[model samples]
Target: MKDSWRRLAERLGGRLAFQAPLRELTSFRVGGPARMLARPEDVGELQELLASARRERLPFIMLGGGSNLLFDDAGFDGLVIKLGAGFAGLEGAGSLVRAGAAAASADLLAWTVARDLGGLEGLAGLPGTVGGAVAGNAGAGPEGLGRAVTRLFVLEGDGRARSIPAADLNFAYRRLEGLPERAVILEAEFALTSRPAVEIRARLAEIRERRGGQPLGGRSAGCVFKNPPSISAGRLIDECGFKGQRVGGARVSEVHANFILAENGATASDILALIDRVRQGVLARRGLALELELKVLGPGGEVRA
Candidate 1:
């Protein structure tokens, strides 16, 4: 299987590396490695690569900026494809901003805000790539990234390109419900309100202030669990006295109960174990089982508990 993949990688590009360490790529910095890592130069290349993988019955996963991801220490056994160069631009005019999926969310938001756009202020202080944000429908307060999406250009699971309008999608909490699973977002167009640049900056400043307690610069996936309908996950964890809890090199952030920090030598197992403990504690004490917002990918493409 390794030999077969090596030959295919050669046809695609040599930049594809084997046994690539994923720890440094993630905000958590605790994953082991990817068996075969591939970066597509453009959408065409990505399409061809996917077609080949499907033909070979080789499973492949899309990896964005790796901010909201957690991989097992045993490492992924399938191909990992990361979009590059071609998917790294943000451009539009008037009240519409089009951003490539691989574009950094912060850069894209900053670009729109600088141009006096108002709708994206809700996502100003979040991390990860535009694709990751869109896939997860990440948001703050009552606003989600899906609300501003006007259209999406994506590569469907069967390697067909599609242009879908936001009205056709189900914009729910932390998910784009109607979109097909494994659809690769190439670019997205966001509808924004035209406002004074000063006003947008002020709103962004307010958001930053609100996220001040998030342990922004730490090596941890931001906000580990999704907020339940009744109360916030952080508040529940804090109420359960889960803050400052440490399991090996992983520690629940004292500043924010939802964040689990990974020290230099921390393993993915440590983080996974800590997450289970938090969930168990929350369920046992509050009778409420919190769902995870973060994507936990295991070795065989399964989800870890």
Candidate 2:
């Protein structure tokens, strides 16, 4: 059956739409078309869209800047809701920075450093939006976005908005396990200490310099494998001799094996194959099963195992 969404979206006059390409929204620049992609101009419009989707019993997924995601070549087959400029502003008070979920995480870091707010210097170069970072507890060792987040405003499954403490939210290594699927992160407030602006900026710069040795940029879903306890994923992949391994246009990054780099025109299937190859090699050599750090969005709204 044809979905009733297009007609409804058209009636809204560009507030939402259908069959949007996932490649452009994702950092990997791969994947196929989403069944529907809605850009709500405001919270009211978003609420309206959600209400409609719920009434129709249609599936929907919220997306930010789409970093840290590995979309299948076959893409998603459900509504992909993205909040744009209407939800991407930031404000601050003494030791607090409140940001809209859609606000770019990089912008938040820059703003914090400019204001002499300390504690997130280690996340200087991480890409994607604040909401995704908060959801994933994004960070390097000893510090993550969750640590700074004091409060989060979430639109829960029942369509009620609730304010919650970060500690109350379920956040673990690269995943928020217990949040209801229908919940849409609206905004968050983070705590930071006042510091010398110059010092904070310098520390951010140092992080950037340190991360320079790793492969970033190009079409990638960031780190492909989660670090196992007491060891790094990159080091293990390198040890398995899978660096520079290629299948079609997807290859394990020679610079950092844990990261898979897609040459132009690569498909998500290619990357998936490479991921399997890396895992097999690592498992065979070390008898350890490596878990994924990136979320893989698959076709027909099917959950990827």
Candidate 3:
């Protein structure tokens, strides 16, 4: 199956590599490598690759900005599909904005703001691609991308494109429940209200202010644990005295307890160990079972529990 992807990549002119090091692919910067990695430039190429992988029964996982994700030290055995420049396009009219999957979240936010579009300003400091944000329903506070999104352009395993209404894409806290596990998001359209430029700028500034004290820039996947019930995971962890805790090179950020920062030299094992330690601590001391918010990819690009 690995060789199959390589051969297809050669034929399709898609970027392909064997044993591609993924340490630099993620924000965490603590992964090993991927057995196979393919970056498709366009929807046609992505569909072709997906079709081929499906025919060969080869598992694959979509990788966007590499934010909010962690890869294991052993590396992924399946193909890691990434969208390229062809999917980074952005176009909009009046109060509607259309963006490609590869478009950066920050760029999208800025583009809309420049046009006096109001909807996604809450994502000002978020680090991820449009596709990832939509897939995970990313947000700051109560505002999520799902609220602004009106439509989605997706491709199925059969290489067929479909336009789905946002209402059909039932979104919840950090989850897009209506989307199937195998469906690939190619582009999304957002419906926003026309607002004054000053208002947009003010909202962006407010978000920036609220982001204070959090390690917005770091070698870490945003938040480690999700907010439980009514309280935040950071507050709980801080109350448990886990702030500034270290496990090898991975340490809980003093500024934000939910974030675990990686230093000059850190291993995937170190991050995993730290996460386990925190979970154990919270469960034993606080009687709270922490749930992971960030996605952790196993050796085969499989979801790690």
Task: Report the error of model 1 at residue 146, Å.
Answer: 1.0
Compute the lDDT for candidate 3: 0.87
* Residue 185 alpha-carbon offset, candidate 1, angstroms: 0.6
lDDT of 2 at 154: 82
lDDT of 2 by residue, 42-155 (tens): 777777778777887777888888888776777777788888788898999888989999988889888888788998775688888888988788886534667677888888
Candidates 2 and 3 compared: the better one by lDDT is 3
Give candidate 1's root-mean-square deviation (CA, Å).
Answer: 1.5
- State the lDDT of candidate 3 residue by residue for 144-188, as single tens digits: 789999999999867888899987878788878887668899999
Name the lDDT value of residue 72 in candidate 3: 88
The best candidate in terms of lDDT: 3
Clashes of 1: 0
Q: Name the candidate, 1 or 2, with the larger TM-score value.
A: 1
Residue ranges of candidate 2 with Cα displaced over 4 Å? 1-7
Instruction: Give me candidate 3's TM-score against the actual structure.
Output: 0.96
Each prediction's TM-score versus the true structure:
0.96, 0.94, 0.96
lDDT of 2 at 101: 90
The TM-score obtained by model 2 is 0.94
Scored by lDDT, model 2 comes in at 0.81
